[model samples]
Target: MVTPVRVVIALCLLAPFVAMLWVGSYAKVDPVFIGIPFFYWYQMLWVPLSAALTVTAYKLWQRDRRGRVAAAPASSGASPKGGASE
Candidate 1:
């Protein structure tokens, strides 16, 4: 469980949760805020949150790839040009 991989999983989990919250809040029949409507804010808020979530996921994916590369083992065998029978 690399940190980056963990972060990616967290972000994937968070996006849907946040979206649900926004949807639920907007679903109220009246859907009003202090002055603005819940419907408007909920949708607008998600636009930025969606971008943030995407960026977070991308960053985490890159970090995970870096970790995998660092942990990769060296190749164990010679090339075919060596031409020897086993």
Candidate 2:
């Protein structure tokens, strides 16, 4: 929710995508597997990696949410009528 935390989360999410692009662009890494090109294999590895990253991000988000909820102060008896000023 905080600025730096949000930036870190964004970077974490984008890292695998950048890695995928970098690996996919390589034209010279050879040695085919099951008739597929080496380039395909290398890029395909990101499938599971992406999934792992998603799980990691989800876990991190959950922990962040829990921490925020725990740290939040209890609601007072009287609620504010409308939006608050920054």
Candidate 3:
């Protein structure tokens, strides 16, 4: 079942890709940032943005994986010794 948390994680991973891929949106030289052209500065801004988004996605994935593992049921016949022989 797809959960809200999974949807959020997907957005986190997709945001940077969508922003960076849409080059034409920030292809202008106006709205300069600290003397840097919008074209260059815009792309540079995503460097940090992408890193933060990627970290968030990774952390969310780890949390989800841990939750799944914890919720799994153990085998009924399994022994504490893992069925090992003396």
How do the predictions measure up, each by TM-score? 0.59, 0.65, 0.80
TM-score of 2: 0.65
Which ten-residue region of model 1 has the weakest summed lDDT? 76-85
Please identify which of the two predictions, 2 or 3, would achieve the higher lDDT against the true structure.
3
Between candidates 2 and 3, name the one with more favorable TM-score: 3
Ranking by TM-score: 3, 2, 1
Whole-model Cα lDDT of every candidate shown, in order: 0.66, 0.70, 0.83
Q: What ranking emerges by lDDT with the best candidate at the front?
A: 3, 2, 1
Model 1 — TM-score against the truth?
A: 0.59
> lDDT tens string, model 3, 1-86?
79887998999999988988898898899998899999999899899998998899899988987776566556454334346334
Error of 3 at 62 (Å): 0.4
Give candidate 2's whole-model lDDT.
Answer: 0.70
lDDT of 1 by residue, 1-86 (tens): 55747866687758757776766656653656667777777777777777777787778777776766565543524333333334
Give the residue spans of candidate 2 off by over 4 A: 1-7, 23-25, 31-36, 76-86
Q: After superposition, how far is residue 27 of candidate 3 from its true place, in Å?
A: 1.0
Candidate that scores best on lDDT:
3
lDDT (10s digit) by residue, model 2, range 1-86: 36666666677799787887684465655687788887778778778988887787777877776766565554633223333424
